[model samples]
Target: MNGMKIQITAELLDGLVLAILKQDDYYGYALTQRVQSVIDISESTMYPVLRRLKKNGDLTTYDQPFQGRNRRYYQLTAAGEQRLQEILRLWEQYKDNLDQIFYQRGEQQ
Candidate 1:
């Protein structure tokens, strides 16, 4: 059986994309694929989230030609980058708290 995977909540996914864009600009399909590799999710499901992020002023997109086709790519705005960092910090703190809870409760069966 696969080990218990960390649940990638919707909010977490928003944060994840911003964090990834920090590394490099990526098209929607590429982002969907990359995110799915880490957590099982569909491209269709990803689009709305991306759209919402864009609407919220956290993402900016552009098109680039690659060989024969133009791909639409997304990048984190300064606001998005700052938001990602803040979310990461909070996640880390929450994780520490959860770890303490788990340890206090003892290992699962």
Candidate 2:
């Protein structure tokens, strides 16, 4: 499992970004760090996801001054919240199906 590569799809990436933004707004670097903490992803991979979400109208951005520089912050829109809900619903269904298979196998053996 240590060396196994789990592919993170774009949909999952979008959901993760939206979910993080659902809690509170975050600057680009901070958001990347948060997502990276959960899974192995590069900053290069993260920026495109952010761009896509923003293009899809699921996210909005603003700039705030920090340390004499403006840091761009991302916030979830109403649409983003809706997207997150849908993703959560789908994820639950997928998890449940996998759980059934795993647990049922355990019970059979």
Candidate 3:
């Protein structure tokens, strides 16, 4: 109900988490922030995706002590990383096609 109202289904949220995991390992808050940068979903909506990824063995977590707190850090497993790479390649392809359709091309990175 807040932020941008994009039609994000469950699968898309999973994809978003996988996207961030591709870039770097992150704690819950950090992952939440990173995903928010891409899609305006809130922490509540995002946490379950992380949990589901860990549940489905696409992600792994370790507890690390930092800043006087023990935080659970999320990282992609080999399978998860592979999935990210595959999805990224597909996304790049989609964007390319979309740009051509929009036809106001300068360049996008």
Candidate 4:
């Protein structure tokens, strides 16, 4: 993972957020951390993504009383689930295409 930076597009970020939320609900910080676990991103970056997803009706939020204040948790809507499926399918195809080019060359070595 050293010196390797993978570019994250808006579509990829949306797909990652949706995929993470599909596993379970998470607060903004936790969600940001979860994404950071896989890819390097800041809370600043994630908050906008969350807002966009919610604005698009792909995600919904609920407030939960935790510690002292209300913690906002994000969950996927039905539309989000549909989007996840579509993104996953597209990602698989994209990966296959990339592999055909990248991996084929590796085979010769």
Residue range with the least summed lDDT across 10 consecutive positions in model 4: 100-109
Q: All candidates' TM-scores?
A: 0.85, 0.91, 0.73, 0.93
Report the lDDT tens digits of candidate 3 across residue range 49-105. Answer: 888889888899999999998999999898887777776787788779878769977
Weakest lDDT window of 10 consecutive positions for candidate 1: 100-109
By TM-score, who's the top model here? 4
lDDT of 2: 0.91
Residue 69 of model 1: what lDDT? 100
The C-alpha RMSD of each candidate to the native structure, in angstroms, is 3.7, 2.4, 5.1, 2.6
C-alpha lDDT score of every prediction, in listed order: 0.88, 0.91, 0.82, 0.94
Clashing residue pairs, candidate 3? none
Higher-scoring candidate on lDDT, 1 or 4: 4
Residue-by-residue lDDT tens digits, candidate 2, 15-47: 899999999999999999999888899999999
Q: Distance from true position, residue 35, model 3, in Å?
A: 1.7
In model 1, state the lDDT of residue 52.
91
Ranking by TM-score, best first? Answer: 4, 2, 1, 3
Error of 3 at 78 (Å): 0.3
On residues 1-109, what C-alpha lDDT tens digit does candidate 4 reach at each position? Answer: 4698989889999999999999999999999999999998888999999999999999999999999999999999999999999999999988988997977843554
State how far residue 25 of model 2 sits from its true place (Å): 0.5
